[model samples]
Target: MDTYHKFAAFADLDVERFKHFQEEREALSTLKAVEIDTDADTRLTALTADVKAFKTANDNDIKQLKQQINASTKTYQRLSPFYEQRIALLDQSEAVIVQDDDLYDEITRTKTTQLNADRLDDWRNRTMVLHHQLNKAHEQAKLKEEAERAREKALIRRRVALQQRRQQASLKRQRINETKAYRDRFDNLVVRVRNRVDTLDFKVIDAPIEVINAAEAVAAQAFIFTTLKHTDSFTTLQKSLRDTDAKKIATQVQKAATSLWQQLERLPDNQDKVEVLTKINERFDHVPAITIDGATLTQTVTEHLQKTKNAIQAHEQAQTRRYSSPRPF
Candidate 1:
């Protein structure tokens, strides 16, 4: 408790009782010196009462100020958690800048003398705004992340489709190339077989009955094989017609060679039979699996023909001599 300064009017007053006359005398004396004419006792009493009222008013003001400071402190305590939570939210967002440190520094450095409800309310409202901004940033970031994920998913699907398309194209190209190669090989085989048939020497035909028939069969086989045309797929053509025709040509040529050898066995040893055999052997040279040694056969046939001619002439002279009369004898 601090004591206030005493009023000058009561400085020399009696301690026991308030003497009105003495106060009046003093006030008058003081007034006379200041050259003022006024009621002494009345003025002194009024002045004293005014001083008392001023002190009372000042005491009331001090008490009301203390009460206001206590109320503000309680309000700040109630709002503190909300303010700190908003600050935490802002820190998490990294998008909102609360600047709480700057505010604290400014207040601390400047020596703020008061804390009030108005300032606390301002802090509360400002924190709410920051919280709202942080929420908006969170929503926007979420939406952006979802959009990016959708874009990535769509890109993956497009890439997969592209890869599948590439694979399909590659497979189609490979099939086309394979088909072309098969066709080329088939055409080449056909051309070769045709040319071989065309060049075959089917000119001479004089031979035994079986030999002639066999030669005719071989000729027919060659004609049919050479004239056969390609059909749908190469595999089908080879399986159904081409392979069959090729086997038939081989069979006929083999049959012809067999028949010719049988006929040669039956025919008498003469130049005519030898010449026919040579021609047959030469024609079959173009056929597969047929070989001929024409030079050796011809040499052998010429010697046999000369020997038979000489034997026939000698027999006819002996018979003529036996049947005629012996004129020379």
Candidate 2:
């Protein structure tokens, strides 16, 4: 520390010691919220204030300590030489200072002495109180920390719930897109089948090969769920929460549509594709499987995405039009 601060600390050691001398050592750190106030009052009024300050409690309480072992008396006696030093520094009063002979020889020792005595006590009392306040501050800080921990925990749980909701939303989106792709391919296959039956040259194409190599194109959309790692802490009164969105998806599904447009694409157009497909059509509820080899399901997926976006936007707009309520809390 700097010189002034060091001396100030030395002068204020009583209060510092009091804080450190608390019943609970741990509470000392908590109560550190108390501000350090080192400003002293003017000598005259200050002395009088110290004698009565405890009765008039404001931010800092009055320090009223029973004089123990006459320490002040002993201190004043030892420091009396300093008073003489001050007296020596003052030259005899000249005619310029005093016109009257009687007054010229006189010194206001009584008033000065009383002022000094009172002022001395004021300093002692203030120091005692400063230490007392530091202790109180530490206690208060501990309580504040407890409250903060509780708030932090609640906030973490809220964030986790929001994250889970987003993951669920993303999962649903992937499922819908894949389903749509299958439908689109099925539709295309249906169109080709009708055309081929009408033509005289009847022939079959390999299922997987036809789907991927078809004149029509299909897209692969990737997306999935994740579990995060170590980011949480607990305190005496509560705990801290932490989370990160920096992980990769752990799963995927491939959607391929064939040359025939299998709304269902379940059966590749191989040797037994006709019978297998016939049974599939008889077994399933939807024709997207039969009519289109997975309908160019691309358009369907794009539509679903657009619809979701539109619905979200519509909801936002609706929300904008409505008035919100105040929280009961």
Candidate 3:
């Protein structure tokens, strides 16, 4: 009963205010007419012509004003959804309400207004402001990404230079080693990989030198064709040799890496997938070193694998906590 009385009081107050607003609005129209006729000393014919011209201009202005308002409303509606989606993508929950929907809604709510020109212009300007802000934010983000890419490229060049220098010092010594020795090393690395998988832990591991060498052996070993069936064959064992088909081998390795990644993606959330993906991604990070594209591949795979591993670890941690927590009373 108290709730009903309160609602009734609110309704009565709204009715009274609406009646008063109507009376004031009508008075404003009368005031406008009185202003137009205030200069009675002027010639009647000229005054009548002036009033007709004013009405013509007002009608034209109202038509253009309404068109602007409608166009602005449409633009705001179209971009509002995109803005919301972008905010969601960026995970910015707080800024989800950019230019509130209510702003646009208020502009579109009424068909009639005493100050239509002022209201329409204000609404249009508000939408333009929001549009400008979105464009500025997008451009700034693009610039930031470009700058990051430039920095990454510089870092990659340094890494490639360091790798090349290391390879040059070892090239002569490596060439003098017996063919049997190279084959033995390659087989040992493959065995190491099998061992790693058999005793796998779910935690992420660094890209070990043995892992990197094994990946290189997959593409560079002379006996790789005999050792691993259904694998690609390269002409030369030494990657530095001109006869080696580095590009073709790189493509094959890339395909294999992508296949492994797809398998990882399809796996259900489990420790087995995490362990498998960690080894696969380590191989991915170092495999392309026998070719010119190694630096690019390493950088790309490093960023991707780090993010993926971090997310998986976080989920695992969360699950552990959830299961281990004490129950409430």
Candidate 4:
């Protein structure tokens, strides 16, 4: 009966140990669904090591207990269920450990995949930003090149315009010089003609016919010049030449009137003188009215002729009275 009570106490002790192992396995199983972190990984490793230690210890204890149970067939038969229970608890513990290990491995793989995906996204974003910057730089460079080309074209155009302006200015200066030379030559010719006209003697009666012809020739030449240019200077030269010709004509009329008066004074008979004077007056009638020194030459000739006629008549009357009065002898 004492041996029976000892075996019963051992069986109760083994049952309590089995209950403790089940509680430990239940705790390990709870870790299977824990949130993954450094602390969780450490806890899983510690739990896995603890489970291995417990399993090894349980295996040794079971081996020793089996040896002790085989030494007594009665103890073996009585503790068989407890041995099976321990084996089942070890198997359940191993399964729990395997589940926790799988959970940890899955969590680790998921974290590594997420890290690789984040790296890829970062690389792509950086590449896109770099590409955008390169494109912007290229566009700016293109714009700068276009602006430079435009400026170069503008500069070239300005240079061409400046060259053309310079050419035009040079041509204008040359034309002005040519015009001035022409004007100078014309002025010199006019001056020489005026000098020649100034030297003529138009007031003298016996002014040589050759001189008169020369004067006329000079006036014709001056007229030709006037027709060519027709400036104020040429107009003045023409007027001077005309005045010279008029003065020469007036001198000729005065000389003719003086010669007629001399011929009438030399006549012996009044009738002869009358006839001569009548012929002279008839000839003078055809003469043109000409002015000399502000008086008309035809009017002066008429007054002189009238005075000569009166003197001749008076002399004739005196001669007649002498012949009619008793001879002074």
lDDT tens per residue, model 3, 1-329: 34346456656755775575556445544544446563433444444565567567657655766676677677667666644443342243224223557754564344332224455456556656766787798899999999999999999999999899889757755665534454565567557654553343322443344443433434333123223433434223533332233344445666644543444455554555455445655544433333223444345445545666677788989999998999999
Instruction: List, residue by residue over 168-280, the lDDT tens digit for candidate 1.
Output: 99877766766666556657765765565556543445666675655545544544444443334455434454566556656665565456455556766556665665665
What's the lDDT for residue 203 in model 2? 26
Candidates in order: C-alpha RMSD to true structure: 15.8, 39.4, 41.4, 28.5
Q: Can you tell me which runs of candidate 4 are displaced by over 4 Å?
A: 1-127, 195-329
Give the TM-scores of the predictions, in the order they appear: 0.34, 0.25, 0.23, 0.27
**Whole-model lDDT, model 2:** 0.39
Off by over 4 Å in 3: 1-102, 110-115, 175-329
Q: lDDT, candidate 1, residue 307?
A: 57
Candidate 2 has a TM-score of: 0.25
Task: Give the 10-residue window scoring lowest on summed lDDT in candidate 4.
Answer: 199-208
Worst 10 residues of 3 by lDDT: 221-230
lDDT, residue 166, candidate 3? 84
* Candidate with more favorable, higher TM-score: 2 or 4: 4
Residue-level lDDT tens digits of model 4 in 171-244: 77766665565456556765765455444332232333443343234343433344343433433444445355
Scored by TM-score, the top model is 1
Instruction: Give the per-residue lDDT digits (tens) of candidate 2, residues 1-329.
Output: 24345446545764654454443334333433343234222433444554356235422321322232255567568668546543542343232223333332333233334435444444334444544665577778877887888889889888999898889888677556654554454355445544533331112332344532321222111111111122123221111111212121111122323332443244432334443333322322211221132433444333333444565577777777674655466
CA shift at 11, candidate 1, in angstroms?
A: 35
306, model 1: CA deviation in Å? 31
Which regions of candidate 2 deviate over 4 angstroms?
1-112, 115-126, 194-329
* Ordering by TM-score: 1, 4, 2, 3
